[model samples]
Target: MITCQDILELQLDGVELIAGEEGLDHPVTWTYMVQTRPFAEHMNQGNFALCVIDYVRYDFEEAQRAMEELYELGISGFAVSVMEDREWIPQKMIDRANELALPLFYIRWEGASFVDIAQSVGKIILEHEIQNKRTGDYLYNLLFGYDINDRYIEKISSQFGINFTNPCRVGIIVADRRYGINLEQDEHIYEYYANYLN
Candidate 1:
């Protein structure tokens, strides 16, 4: 019986609450996001646990049984994530998600077809995920204010080891709708760009 509040806040435009129950709490096999690595801060791998216990119950046996059932049902993080985005990911299905630690995803588009609904939904989710990560990283670096170019200092290059042969600056480049999103000043972004150039 995960309540609406239990669903974590997201940057997405909207996520439909297709008939959620208040009293029918299920396991914690729900993956709120699709991008796992970028969102290690939020939906970290296996950080959220599954449980049937109420607000007061705290027994290990019950948890063990529930987890066993969930695992046997074929619920992984990735799988559970895909289920949660669907309008109707059942309790039993949730239990399965707990077992597998699957992330929430849309069903209309799951295959390789770029035109499918799953692909469309995936694009939106990925964009939101990347944006949130980029903003967080940028803000963190801005507050810390460390010099990233120093790390790349070499004998001949300017601060960031340009190597002279192919002299140029570097910055992370992410391709968006016919455009490239360049976060050049941030350390992480520069690191990505530097590594990519090398």
Candidate 2:
């Protein structure tokens, strides 16, 4: 579970104070100031971001670009340092992450409150985005199966959103992994196919 102290430590432990060293120790409410900035007034609390790729190419400059853009747009997101070489993750990257101060959502704690809070916000935003994008194209493919309806191939759409498109036949994927841990990328298939299996 995420404790207040855990948050303080994860953030403080990874950061390197550059210019705004004060921001690190600053109250979480100072996030409000970031939210109100000209570029990001539209952003609000409980907003979350997820960034995925071949963590190999993850770079400090890339992190900076993404953070600056999101800050302007008023969103809160944290990047996972999935890389091994500690040297690759530079002070600027740490500084940038600290400035933006997005939550680290990749790790799991049995009952971390702060992680749960961030996830709740992120899930809502993603769900809304998916709802807006489901222009009947998804349901059609979902029922008919994408391979059978190949001619009707559309831009690969999202199930849980965030651009993970999967084509489901009449099969449900059952995993031994824990609940939320295994739910990524293939839920719609389970929605229909699970009934057949269960």
Candidate 3:
């Protein structure tokens, strides 16, 4: 789970958290740039929203409303870059963010770039996904490999932090024709269930 806290840890230039400290652990699935009105429609759950205050033309009240909508949409976090006149995010907006436990970030426009922040976050998410795939492959090998041995089990256990020393059980679901409903006839349905179970 690549999270808001993980993004902050990157310490990107001119980026800092201004509110919603308690929501730092919110998982971020992707990044979104909010340039149009009704931005919630363009966003999805676990998206980290990036916006330029001037570009959005949002006043304090409007910004607060947008934040509430984003929170309702399950946005992971919000980052706003302000123009020189504003200098900082409104205190009322900060208070509302704290109350909602929605991570709010401020990016100084002088030296920071939204592209750079988005790219860094994207890289972290991709790397985490790749690592998960590798772990899954290792587990698959451990379950079906022909030359499995005590040494191999121990190595895999240690490498993946699996406590194989304890009792464990594996459950398999076999899909077949039942009551005239043939699962094999529609592989998509079977795959959907397999992914859901996984």
Candidate 4:
């Protein structure tokens, strides 16, 4: 999974983790540039939010409230750009983020642009998805390839780091339409289950 730690490794200019170091493993499914209040309503779980401290008007109370709301919403992490004059995030906000284990990041106002951070994160996510698709294709071929042979199986298994010698079982999922489910909306859930099963 693409995670907060992975984003940190990109080392975008002037961005640093300030609190909740233990939460660096939080999976980041998407990134958002937040510039408005009540932004939590537009966010979803696994979202990494980026914004300026101006979102809270540099008020400690507003910052606290925003962090609390983001935590409750399962936001993966937060990155706030501090204005030159301010130069710091509120201590109370940092304390609250540690308590919630929600990774909090700091960005120098004149450092990385929000667009750059968002695009970098987006690229990482896309690359991860592409790799997953390629792995899936390899597995599909293993299951159905007409010319399967010991050498071919060994090559595929070694390439993907799978232990082909281990006992394995296959499962079949049959979806019923009696309840009229929204396939599009539930597609991610299916992917989650597939990964879990694998």
Each prediction's Cα lDDT score? 0.34, 0.39, 0.78, 0.77
lDDT of 3 by residue, 94-129 (tens): 998899888999998785798999899989988876
Give per-residue CA lDDT, model 1, range 1-198, as digits (tens).
221233323222333222223311322323333222223333322222222222234233333343344334432322221222333445664454334434332222232221232334335445544654555455456448667454333442332223445655645455233323433224333433332332
Residue runs of model 1 more than 4 Å from their true location after superposition? 1-18, 21-115, 146-198
Estimate the lDDT of model 4: 0.77
Cα deviation of 90 in candidate 4 (Å)?
1.6
- Candidate 2, residues 1-198, lDDT tens digits: the string is 112223334443332223333333321211221222233433432233333323444455655565567645544344333343233445666665555554333322222333444544335434534554464446555666745543344344333333425554554466433345435323523432332233
Error of 1 at 83 (Å): 18
Q: Which is the leading candidate under TM-score?
A: 4
TM-score preference between candidates 1 and 3, better one: 3
Task: List residue ranges in candidate 2 displaced over 4 A.
Answer: 1-46, 52-57, 85-88, 97-198
Ranking by TM-score: 4, 3, 2, 1
How does model 2 score by TM-score? 0.29
* Predicted structure 2: lDDT: 0.39
For each candidate in turn, the TM-score is 0.24, 0.29, 0.79, 0.81
lDDT winner, 1 or 2: 2
Against the correct fold, how does model 1 do in TM-score? 0.24
Best by lDDT: 3
